[model samples]
Target chain A: MELLDFARGPALQFALAVFVLGFLWRIVSLFLMPRTKDRSAARPGTRPALFAATREIIRRTAPDKAFGKHSLFALVNGYVFHVGLFIVIIGFAPHIVFFRDLLGVAWPSLPNNVIYAAGVITIASMMVALVRRFLNPVQRLISTLDDYFSWLVTFLPVLTGLLANSHLWVRYETLLAIHILSVELFLIWLPFGKLMHLALVFVTRSQIGTHLAHRGAQI
Target chain B: MTREINVQAAANRFLAQISGNLGAYMEACLHCGHCADACHFYAVTDDPRYTPAYKLFPMARTYKRSKPPLSWFGGAPKVTEKDLQEWEELLFDSCTMCGRCTMVCPMGIDIASIVAASRQAFVAAGLGPPDLLQAAENARDKGSPLGVSADVLADRVEWLADDNEVDIPLDKEKADVLLTVSSIELMKYPDSLVAMAKLLNHAGIDWTLSSKGYEATNFGFLSGRSDIAKIMIQRIVDAAESVGAKTVVIPECGHAYGVLRWAGANILGKPLPFEVVHITEFLADLKRRGKLKLKPMGDAVTYHDPCQISRRGGATQAARDLLDGFATDFREMTPTGNHNWCCGGGGGVQAMSRAAGLRHKVFKLKMDQVEQTGADTMLSACANCRLTMDESKEHWHWDKDLGSLVEVLAEHIDESNAAA
Candidate 1:
């Protein structure tokens, strides 16, 4: 568990604490921010309406099933990248060791080869999304430097991790340290980036649910 | 039925007709597809060509490539002769100018405005629209969008009085509320008129329907004819002013609500002397004040978000407020409020028969929403949306009742004399 040792150097500790505090602040803002009053009248007693509204929110926000409606390669490849990357993030053996020691909990880690493969796929998919954003006029119009930079920020960890894990570039210790640090940085940025929708989903869903309950509709 | 004008000349005329509006607002588009799915026609048809983006591209490219920095790139996505021909149908026939597209657009491009401009472009090019739009244009020029002349307007109001045994105050000078309605309410949606009358009576509100500025629904909003939109709205503002009505109330038509609430003041060159309240907003106010009472239906009721009244009219919460209090079970359509999908009507597409099939297809979003809800009845606040839902119900055989919020509330209005 020596590698499970804390990168407790003041630099890493400071970065980690700032990341944790900043992430919580973003989540809090989403919860406390007031949206314009929904045009619907508020009726607190309508249980059925609230349930229906809740159910509708869940149904609508559920992931799109008609991947064909989106570009097939984009949708399938994007999902593979996201899902795979998520697995590698938590399922890599070293990550599990760190989590178990630090958080006092751990899930079974994926085999080393699988984690490396997922990282590669994730990097490829990130490139595709970036290229598409640049090439498409509509996407080009809407995108800003911040958006492109965010993608690179996200893709960097996975690309670095794969190189580090496979020993293709640098020593394993150096690459692992960089990967862990970059990940901490990403964690800090998530709530601030467009990724903050994760916090918003709950609020929106609950609002719609409470609203429908007032209308006496079940979800 | 009106005779169709020559398509080529109509397209050219359409361009001339919208030159004024084009000069002002045509440069506002940034081509975000947020407006694309917001359009009922696009939703129903599932046609990318009908998207506000694609529909406006030919014209935008034409102006861009020929006019400025964009012309250096050969006008980014150069428009072809075929694109021009294809766009006539996309702009004129497919769009309803509902302003639903405009409401959802983040940049607020006013795609409906652009569609209106494109329709004018088509008209100028000798690509006249179908019989219904042409008739509406002719009617607008003559007096009403429905071709209801001054004499017919008077007769219709009188017929309403005789038919319902309620006297509609005509041209009353300085009433507290100048209640206005679109032409459809006069021509076919008598039930809406009856509901307004009953509500006004129940609330004991001082209101009068204007005989002079009778038609509140402006076809100019549809055809992208600013002169017509201005003239049509001015007539209502003038009538309301002449009558000294403190507030102007718009009924359940989406475009009419947008005209008065969103664009009315601008058209008049000042804030309207009176506040323009949509019927839903008015009804919500009455309920809030305990002026109107609803007997709970205690049945499964789903709500449809009319593009104009909910999103455009700034009263998305009002309709829900009314429906929530009255229905035993009220379900919301997916993507409700400003994010709600169109009912495949709006703009002037409801009148153009050639676009009906495409319009119906664009309504698939609503149809899918309705299906998901599994509610037996759906309520809407716009006549066109209600009508479009009814048509979708029949076409899809959804076995659901489509109705206006007022109509539903009006039905449940406990007219018990014993309580009084």
Candidate 2:
């Protein structure tokens, strides 16, 4: 089969199946695990714990004031990469067309130039993050194979997508096929690797906030 | 030869202890190492193994093995007896279970709570430190981790009553407050008891110390054994209930307040019959209501926020408010309040002799923070923190006077209020 045909048909189907079924199974089994009951009394006369949880979902994404200066590099690059990726994935015109075609939902898209700029910035930030992970001793010590693998899988799609969109160094159809394949690989790896943070960031942050707030902490 | 550790049993125990929050924290950690700067152990020692996220490695590995999708592949690292041994040092000795790391984590993972669960797993594997185990045993059987007997408490109370010409009420029925203290205070600083008695007498509040439950430190909570913590705290609950007291006053011991304030309800499986208040909060409330008056002291004093009382127990504002009321030159530690660094000796680390060298090493961070303020007096509400600071002072050969807020207040009690 041609690379384009393989990427468009069987590979796409397989990636979607793994992504959907893997996520469903992971989340279900996680939620099904026996959780110890938090019998501690809630803080007296404050907003509900869920409100605190929601607030923290927004609050913790930014650097905490206490450690903000020390963590500025990570925070800035992390936010840039994440926001840039969001725009590239959801707001770009071509991606919106794909989404609308696949799922019958649509939103207004950013200009092509703006999408290109965001993609470039995202790629640059990912490069900085990868270099820091390899160079910084502390980060290096804590990093696992899963961490490096996830970074590579996540970084490739954006790179290949940008190359494909620019139609550089390859035929448009061939580059698009490679980009799609890279994205499929990322999707297949998402539920099983550190990339699971996409779903777990909310779960973990909110849980921390709810518990702390119930104890009357101001987090 | 190393004693055989049941790796399967340890993994099961860890999995069983997994709360929804813990599971989410394990899965969500980005391994960014941002929490390293917040941890005193890692910051002072620059040891990567002491990094908060690194400390959670074994438990996270075990969690992944239990998790699906990944579990199907079975590629997650296996938990071994050797891994548990190394983790015992990482979780119990090096890390103090301080929540500073939790405060700074962008992912908002409560790494400290996860460390506590890891300690529980260590205990389940029969690998908890002997010192902590003995302390828990003492609290379980002897009623006090320090082995302070009921007679010793009675004797101390009698001595304080005679020395201060104040009525020291013990086991009084139907008091308004049941005052409890740590054995550390009783043994190392009985003057804090004197201060408490004099203040309570000055306020004209009905309070008594119970011989049965006056010991406030809960080693079970520190050791991560809920059953033992429940037993230790229930003695106080029964004492307060028996006296029909409206409130239980936890003294300047941070962990005491932590156990009674945060974990009290959960241990009893219901709301505590009475209100639990830290002395700082209680005193601050009285001052806010104009019920207690204090004479201002003019010396520059910095207050060390205890991890349990301020960060974990929500008493930061009260301690600051009380300090504002009493000290004319109150200096703030950089990163004070809930973000304060620990004194390197909490979460039962103070009791573990094996952790002494590491504890002292981590304490350099707190020492430098305190020194930066250039304050002559360092005051904290937690007795354990005060004890740790005192040791730090001696180790570093610093001349700062380590003081307790309760005793400081006692020294400057408004003479007019005393007459009232």
Best by TM-score: 2
Per-residue alpha-carbon lDDT of model 1 for B1-420, expressed as tens digits? 433445444434434434322422343443334454455665554555666666776566455444322244354564555666667777777766655554333233446656666666655554546564565576567677677776777787788878888767777666899988766777777778878888777777888877668777787767656667788888887888888888788888887877666666656566667777788888898889888877888878788777666554456788878877688788876766766777776776677767667766766677678778878777887887776667766777666677777878878887563122
Global lDDT of each model? Answer: 0.65, 0.85
Give the clashing residue pairs of candidate 2, or none.
none
How close to the true structure is residue B259 of candidate 2, measured as C-alpha lDDT? 80
**For residue B288, what is the lDDT in candidate 2?**
81
Per-residue error for A7 in candidate 2, Å, reads 2.1
Q: lDDT per residue, candidate 2, A80-185, as tens digits?
A: 9999999999988888888998899999999989999999999999999999998877899999888999999999999999998898989999999999999999
Number of the top-ranking candidate, with lDDT as the measure: 2
**Candidate 1: where is the Cα deviation over 4 Å?**
A1-219, B1-46, B77-81, B97-110, B415-420
Q: Give each model's clash number.
A: 59, 0
